[model samples]
Target: MRVAVVVMETSHHRDTEGRRHIERLAATLNEAGHEVSVFCAQWWGGNASRFEPDEVTYRGVTVEPAETSFCTRLPALLAKYRPDVVHAFPTPSSVLRAANAGAKLARAPLVVEWFGDHEESVSARAIGTANQFVTPSELVQTELWEAGADSDLTTVIPESIDMDLVRDVVPAEEVDVVYAHPLDDSANIESLFLGLAELRQKGWSATVIGDGPERDTYERAAADLRIDDRVDFVGSCDRERRLAIYKGAQVFVQTAWREHFATELLWALACGCIAVVEYQAESSAHELVEHRDRAFRVTTPQEIADSIVASADMDRRTVDESLAEYDHAAVVEQYEALYERLVDEYGLF
Candidate 1:
């Protein structure tokens, strides 16, 4: 099947969530043996648009970059590609509208992928497209139903992970704890910081990986809390380097306030961090960590702190066994089935 996936623009420097998601999905379709192409708008951030390479054929996607709008961009490209399915995972309202218009122009089967609340605002504007909705978690499916979509037409397709990349992981040895991402409120980063602070006071060391808008702020939070000496802010780390960090981390922490898939948590598990997640009841984080016997979930920083301290002394073999569920091959197979379903639905020839 000839499939044309569309996105508003692409930026190499800051490969945002959607960019990475699109590349992965397009590759998945290609892996499923479908002819895939990407039609994109050329919107370079903080700079005037310049066209050097408008056509890029990579990852089984023939990318066509143009300065086109919803009225013209996707429709014009679809008219040219004439694909059997027009799949668009729009990141924003305007962008999704453009893709919706483009899919209509192509007159092909439409599938809207959602990682968060998209259909809530876009459904009324979509007019009436016979499009199936795909999401990585139940939260997204519920959101789509709330947005007036037929629940039957919505499917849950778990995200895929490239376990091969994590295969060389040294697997943390004696490290007490590991926390990726910056210290922020939404992620309950403050809580994690406080939890670590207490642990540090009790003589535990944690490596804080990743950077964000609140780096300096978080560093100060650690200092103000008097746990700075116990925490190491390693800044951002590429996966290869991160695998080595994971090698010694006995505990993995993710404090995101909300998550559609909570992917990094899985990666941490793959790297041998006994996963600890903090989430609200309604969050998708709760959905991902459902088998809590394998991982622990808490609602308060105190709970997190207490759990960490209690679990720190947990048996090594139990920790290792718990993380086995996230092995890359197992996760990838879930995605493989999802792609197959999409292909079957569209009859990608």
Candidate 2:
């Protein structure tokens, strides 16, 4: 199957979770032996119209991130590419409409990926443009439906992880608890700190992974709470290192105020860390642990501290086979199946 991915910008242009998801999906599809091409505003230097960075082909629809030219030129390029399916993003709203025109011109099925971080008004205006919609979580799916996407036309596809790495990486030095996320205001790391502060007498150490503008603020919070010595703020680790940390940790604490999908929490769970998610209205972290064993949903520091202590009694594991359903290969198969079904329905074969 051939897939033409339409986007105004990519992770290279500006690092964002949605862009990262799209880029990873395109690479995964290409790795699965399907032809994949991404049409976006050129981020590479020089005047070349096309660039192949890895397995995926990135075709520059415009020299820079010019919204108007990108919207104007994308249709012809996509039509010429003649893809079986046109996969698009709903960020600027205009881009989806442009992609819709291209999909119609190419007679290909249009699928929109709504990652729940964009404006709802734009998504509401653009939802009807695509033949199908994909979201990273049911929370996002509900948001998509509320934004005028038909529930029948929408599906939830969780983020994928390299399960082989989870299974094979050697565990890092053991720690009692772990937390991972960019240290921003939304990180709410204070919740974890307050919880840990309550257990200052307990023999538990934590490793906080990730870095951002608020790193100093979080570190100071740890100090004010007088738990700085026990918590290690090892910033921005690669995936393999994170997996090793998660594998070695007894508990993974998720206190972020918002998450389209709790990707790091999923990684921690797959690495066999007990999930202790603090409930937040906007975050979908709680969804992953609903009705699951060794997972606790809490609302306060006291509960978080209690959960961490309880995790000590649970069995230790370096990997959980049950989460194999979210392996990269499995999620790519979901995309392939969705594309196949849409192609069949469109009689594009």
* Winning model by TM-score: 2
TM-score of 2: 0.97
Give candidate 1 regions above 4 Å deviation: 11-15, 43-70, 91-107, 117-120, 182-185, 317-349
Q: Once superposed on the true structure, which residue ranges of model 2 sit more than 4 Å away at CA?
A: 119-123
**lDDT tens readout by residue for model 2, 1-349:** 9899998888888788999999999999999999999999998999998999996899999988898889999999988999999999886788899999999999999999888876435756577788999999988898777778788999999999989989999999999999999988899999999999999987889999999999999999999999999999999999999999999999999999999999999999999999999999999999999978989999999999999989999999899999999999999999999999998898844
lDDT of each: 0.64, 0.92
Candidate 1 per-residue lDDT over residues 1-349, each given as its tens digit: 6777765554452355546666577766666566777655444343423332324333211223432334354566676677777777644455566666666666666777666633235655652453677777898778767877788778887666556666655554466778886344555568788777666558788888878777888888889988888788888888777777775777787787666676767666666567678876555766666775647888788878987887777654312444445554554465455545765765653
